[model samples]
Target: MEPSSSPPAITEPAAAGSGEPLAHRRLVFGIVAIALLMASIDQTIVATALNAIRGDLKAELTWSGWTITVYALGQIIVMPLAGRLGDQFGRKKIFLGAAALFTVASLCCSLADNIYLLVVFRAFQAIGGGAFMPTATGIVAEQFGRDRDRAIGMFTSIFPIGGIIGPIIGGIIVTYWSWREIFVVNIPIGLLLIVLGLRFIPSSVPKATSRIDGTGAFLLAVTMLFGMYGISSLGSAGAEPTDPLFIVAMLIALVLGFLFVRHANRYATPFIPISLLRGRGFGAMNTINFLFGAAMLGFGALVPLYAESRYGIPPLQAGTLLTARAVGMICVAGLAVFALRRTGYRAPMIGGFVLVAGGMTLMSLAPHGLTPYAWLAMAAGITGIGMGLSIPASNNASLQLAPDQISAIAGLRGMFRQSGGIVAVSVTTAILNHATDAGTTQAHSFVVFAAILLLMIPITFLVPDHRGTW
Candidate 1:
């Protein structure tokens, strides 16, 4: 196929409100919100409990790390597909299916006898989890027509709540009960969402019918696999960057990545739209978001482990470290979300990154005069404030450039950050496997991450600088 000047049109259903009452629409929104919160919590909840899982399963650092890696991998891959599937089929059917799938997968996860089993089950859980957003977004978009932006914003805000509460809840479960209790807790909640959804979710007709780009999906998958494996191998103690195996793995990833890009640019309906990647203003936002994902979401995943490993803090306490960050994030993110239309994208984002970088630098340092817990909490809070300030703008920056393709833009933006996260955690775990002092190594890694965040500041100038109050 020849390359096109623009991406294939995203299949946007008519923006019709089906005469649903405002109270009714909110009920539907709440049902989906519960599932979203469940999925969101699952993302970070495991971080606090991971060490316990590893010790119980007797898994290696790199292998156990795949626990986080696999979930992200599944989500990035499934998101675009889910969006199209929801539009092709009915959103109601897709929403209920995803919820049921997540519930069943949670049960399977709770029963896993080993880390390998858990990873496999976790991938299925991720597929269900990944489907929730696009399908739910479709449901909400139809529910509130002119007010969709506000509804969506309100919906999106639920994510940080999950981030804030996930670790603390996980910490509590693991502290009071077995780590399996984390999964056990989901079973009841998931069931409730499914029943509530069936009773309340409006039935929307399939808006479009189309096929997914199998070739593009395949190439993207293999490319990430090769890159992840190469990094994992090279991070070993005796393995040099020049190692033949590492070089081969990376080369394969590069070649495959090139093919994936070509397919994306040229295909009629590529798995990932080329326009989203190369569109004006898109390049800057995607790049900065990738770095943001690596610095905040990716490194943030390891904070509990870092606390437990470096400071010899207990699981319950280490878990609170993330809570501290979330506390800061919630405090600022709510304000930033409301402020974005007034301040423009640049202010909150630049300020957020500065706080993030400074906070991370503080975390890397010793307690100095304060207790390790107090010192780390203060640093984490500082970092959280940075995240809170920036995240809302980071989310909205590119969307303004191409509002029609909201689903595609949102999926791709998430994919970049998640892709960055997969690589970061993969490499970090690989290095930790060989480190003589895991804590010191992890601390030093944060410093390096902070330095990298500093370099990202100048690029924000390229990001969309206008306020959205227009």
Candidate 2:
């Protein structure tokens, strides 16, 4: 494969050197951004609605959490495959198909009458969503042509704002209407993206043909399913640390994953593509991303727990406190574009992690009173800024290493990041469960967790700030 000249940034149709007018080009990218926001927001929206969803379905507490796990597990299995599929076939077709699948699944989720059915539908929804991340990243890269540094920076920043808004919207809808409204919201957004995408998303640049690694895909699926199930089972009453069945299942998953890695290296086209993993900067960025994912989950799970437990707030109020945090994230995410452009990533990554660690640590120190709102707000703002800043740098590093195979590699990165979230939730929940006999214990346990996460700061510097080609 030879390096060809990069295309111009496709801000408008003329910028893309297309026959279309400037208005049409802006219309195209605007629609793509909307589609991207819809998909990313859905990932976080359901977080705030878990309690209502579980109660309505009369699900066991442990089972209700699977609503999150099942969706992520499905994505873990499908993301890598989507990357390769998009690379081999075409990004636009797979993207549209995935969007349609996502819309259908969301409708099914809205209509679900049973907990089991809802979980199944959510899994299907993830299969659709898994494609969106990689394909969207690839599309952004393609649209920007060679000027992807700023484009990637802006692209990465937008999703954090979506993450910020999702919980608030989910909370409002579930509070005023029903949990079903969460899924229903995606319909109009999905339809709009589909129509616009068909009109504007460009054809993929032709590349070397690659075979689909079916065996590797199957093994990867097995690995993720068992791994996620094991994670979900932890911190729950039914799964004991010494349980033989649980131990055996975890061992099996590990064994299969090891085999998959070994086999993938030998294949002509590995499911994960070992070449991507070998890049020093890329590998380090993923490691940091995995840890960051875990920290994000800890914050995600802890915020609601604290709002409800300490403040004696109801689900809606607990969710609203989370909304405050989202508002902070939205404010900071926009600044990230300028930050990445003006200064290099090192200062921001280090500073961001420090802020997150500081914020989490401070939250650990929250007193049992209303006056702490100031401290809470400060913490939320700082953490959000840190997350916003760190994300663009990490994503930029990952893209730099694998420009040609952006979709596939990005998908694999998503799998690791999401898996990190699953693990963090499971492990932190387990720790809290073991440590918390009461409210005080829960608070103390959280402080301990936050302190430990603070230790992850030194590792960030190990990541190289490689600015990959546009």
Tens digit of per-residue lDDT, candidate 1, span 69-177: 6787788777766765676667778889999899999999999999999999999999899888878876776665554544565654587789878877887899999
| Poorly placed runs, candidate 1 (over 4 Å) | 1-23, 47-65, 87-90, 113-115, 144-147, 154-157, 171-181, 203-208, 232-248, 308-312, 366-369, 428-443
Best by lDDT: 1
How far off is residue 356 in model 2, in Å?
1.0
**Clash count of each predicted structure:** 0, 1
Candidate whose TM-score is highest: 2
Instruction: List TM-score per model, in order.
Output: 0.83, 0.86
Q: Tens digits of per-residue lDDT for model 2 on 209-308? A: 6767788888888988887777767867646667676687799899998999899889886767777765556667777767777776556656767756
Q: Name the weakest run of 10 consecutive residues (lDDT summed) in model 1.
A: 1-10
Worst 10 residues of 2 by lDDT: 1-10
- Clashing residue pairs, candidate 1? none
lDDT of 2 at 470: 35
